[model samples]
Target: MVETTSHTATVRLPGSKSVTARALFLAALADGTSRLITPLEAADTVAFADGLSTLGFPVDRGGDVWSITGNPTGPPAETAVVWCHDSGTAARFLPALVSLGAGDFVIDASEQMRARPMGPLLRALGSLGVRVHAANGDRIPLRIDADGVEGGVVQVDAGASSQYLSALCLMAPGTRNGLTIEVLDEVSVPYVELTLAMMREFGVTATRQGSRITIGPGTYQARDYVIEPDASTASYFFAAAAVTGNTVTVLGLGRNSRQGDLRFATEVLSAMGCEVTVDDDRTTVTGPTHLRSPGEVVMRDISDTMMTLAAIAPYADGPVRITDVGNCRIKESDRIDAMASALDACGITVHTGADWLEITPGRPHSALVQTRADHRIAMSMSVLGIRTAGIRFDDADCVGKTFPGFHQELAGLQEAWQRG
Candidate 1:
């Protein structure tokens, strides 16, 4: 049994991998050398680096520093096979960018990656005169044959994943002509905003009017950029203080973040009876006397933090319901089932459906959780394990997929036994 105790701790989160990868890709397409500070060095970012390298982008790394030479005129290389592993952002974004090259290029990944839907993206690309083939339905291991993108009007379903829309937008400027994207049933709209905001920082403009976005054919101007702290990773530490009745402050993230998951701190503090103060560069969360369950929270905007919500659910006084998150079913794993199953194993009754999860707090029970090789699952289970008596996580090393220092960060909060 690995015994752990709850304690007060303040932690600083790494830069957002989501933002870093997009910024890196844009920088690679810029006109000159781009400098990115506080960038995440996780597997996903590494995969993005590999994809750029395969396409002839010059990338140099030293310690926590990174430099990318822009290839605004396009790469000198031809089509080649690029593997994105299970990184959806890499898989989705790379395909559109590769369309700028000539020849047949294939993007492949793990079995789980192959299961994630890519039909919406494929259909949208096809509408823009790009040919794509999915070895298994509309999933990964996608093959793309591109001479170049013929820009025109394209319609896409934004309900599935915002990455699809963002990918198209990123590739729009490199097309033969400008492109206009009409979205149908948009969800997780904040992520799209983040993408557009980053594009503007790189000298590309994407105008979002209602559900439609128009991108003009232009070159990306390379410039020095600094990635902001990851809001998703910040949620775990914030939740720690909220659940354990302690004071914890997360540095490098604040009110003016382009990342939408930053809003999670406000929602969590509001629900768990904590006082939240957001300043220019930091956010402090102070726990209350007792945490109360805010039953039925609509989490459409903050869907990425659903796992953190599940981790804190066991501490709530009553049933905690999470809704408007059907998109969770299509992430790195089927988060809906994975969360309910993990919580159920811990002696909690979880009422779950296609799009909602209802968790009732009860006595903590020890159980080994299967993380399904998902980074968020592994992180969430580890956080919950802090409050449990005997907890073991299978594939705990899967945290390297995103946050490589996750275990070390958890160790800072409390003592945990590591088994070989």
Candidate 2:
């Protein structure tokens, strides 16, 4: 970490990856043709769209507005192999989707994503009468023998990932008798809420009572949908503002947005002494004279931003402890360890627990940060480069998983900050 400096810049981000993925899933399951305006064109989304196309769902990824012809009866292909690549969303959500069709589907992921857990979703599908087999056991490179799904009571453990539950919810409306999800344990409940909200937007009703959610048998009616800007991706820019004592305004993401990651601005950044203004259509963050520690912040619901918080924590006045995010251990990388290691390489004092990490204030010297091929790691670590001149990354291009232009955007902000 380096001494804070003042700067100001405004950034326009891509569409929400969460929303784009869910919209593609919902639209493909709709009753008619659907139009998605300004959807994210990234590696993860492209993998998702390709997965859908492989499963026999038609997707036209030509321009700003991509179109998908809905297939309420599930994928038309009787046999398909989906190459999920490194996209966890594609890996988790696609299985439940293919189960709605009468076919044999093989879901294969990249080495990184295959290491993440998938047993919960598979077990829930099995309970719902879909025959599933994981070659690696609980991980992907699994096979789904689909004859169609029957909607009844299903129990799912979403503690490891909320995508498992969201996957089920997205596919519930197409089940034969509707679906009732009994979430045994869950993390990132807000993401599940986003999934539900999108489902309702597509003309389906899903109700949640306590830990149980029920979706009745219905067909999604296609309509033109506008995707919200990605809040998770915006976090790096907001962290830039906080770290450098600058003002960074992100256009199109507001307090009213359904993305749970937006709370990073309202909750985490605000707690860390940043002046946060969340309007209906935009969010702005201005850093303090110097950063202050918010102490312990439980980031289970917004765990995706945990890396952002950790990267900037060493700049604060005191130690910052982020807890309740054990799920961080299983993201695109073992984020808790990865962030701890990167901070250590920066010569910062850090400690770790099973699920938490604490960063003690120190001057983070420039170091060669190992990105582990995780996009968040690369982007979060890049924020340090704003102050630490010699900071570098081994695989910065991993940000292409979401924002391919991250390096350029941060460079622009750094230039503006320097000129001032």
Candidate 3:
């Protein structure tokens, strides 16, 4: 086994991809130039910037900050090509921005993203009067002809993906008729709230009343914003500590941060027997030498960490039950199935249910992991590989979607432990 020696180290992460993507969209749609400080410079966020640039938003990066010029009047290109690649944020959010533009836009993605769900968001855009043309049902390589979004009441079941609702909400302020989004069923509700909170910072108002969100026929005002550290990415390092019996400290993810994934440290890791201490400056995770099961975990809101916890499941002393994470099936990959398959490859017994997974611990054998072109899968599986040998990745580069230096971070972990 390639178990890491117990060590103490504080790691500083790049800015939040979720916040950076939304900020880029809002800044691109605003009237004034907005300065994004310490934004995430990763593949997915870069795809967002590239797509926005294609839509005529000039993004300039110098040092850690990004200066993006907003194009309030829409893209100059009448017919635009927007590439979302493997980013769910770009796939879902960018289409709504196109609907607010006076142009014909075509969006495409990698094979991984093509398999994810987007029909609900597309149909919602169609309800706003944008002509959507999807090839072979509602997949990417689709065309959108938009004079502009004339929003009224748009309904979407965000249960499959909260990005579906965020896609509609981001461009609602720019719509002529405003918008009232009816959430048929919601998952990752905190992410939607984060989007709204960022929207308010950009000078747009989104009032959430129960499942319906009312937004005005308004516009975003560009402002200087600082992106918080990535909480989703933080889960991996936290998992590193948990699996290796080390102390991992993450800097910049303060307690007041908006990224909902931070709760994974508190709810999941701590519940799994790690000692978690959060403060305004940083969060520290001290792993127990012997891992324990936290019983059944319901990961409805903090489902992004589903795979992270899955990576740690093999190390558990007893069976660990995970529930309320059915929506994970539609993420970058079928995470439930991916976890099942990966765990099975490592000799762990995994029982899959419609909305739950029960992972029974065993002496894990090293196995080649398949990432399915999913960032979370790559990262999570990497964590599992740390404490076990023969942990090879089929597509290790997929972590570039969020954490470009993830492998380097793993290397740094080794250095810290060695130094200790």
Best by TM-score: 2
- Give the clashing residue pairs of candidate 1, or none: 31-222
True-vs-predicted CA distance for residue 255, candidate 1, Å: 1.5
* C-alpha lDDT (0 to 100) for residue 240 of candidate 1: 70
Question: Model 1 over residues 1-420: C-alpha lDDT tens digits?
Answer: 122233445668788988888898788778898888879988988888877888788888755678888776565468678888778889999888888777788898778888889989998998888888887668878888888887989999978788898899888888878799999877788888998988898897789898789999998888877788788888887777676666677887888887888777787667667778888988888766677788788888889899998888888788889998999999989998999999888888999998999998876689999899889988887777766768788898898988899888876754312220
lDDT of 2 by residue, 208-295 (tens): 9999999999999999998878999999999999988889889999978999999898899999889999998999999887888999
Ranking by lDDT: 2, 3, 1
Tens-place lDDT digits, model 3, residues 1-420: 234446799999989989999999899988888999999999889899899888877888776889888876566567799888888889888888887778789999988888776788888888778899987777887798879877799899888888999888888888887899999998888899999999998888889999899999887898899988999999999999998889989999978888889988988888877899999989999888788888888889989999898889878878888899999988888899998998888888999988889998887888888888888888998888877778888889988889889999987986787688
- Cα displacement (angstroms), candidate 1, residue 183, comes to 0.5
Best by lDDT: 2
TM-score of 2: 0.98
Give candidates' CA RMSD values in order: 3.4, 1.2, 1.8
Q: In model 2, what is the error at residue 5, expressed in angstroms?
A: 5.7
**Better by TM-score, candidate 2 or 1:** 2
How many collisions per candidate? 1, 1, 0
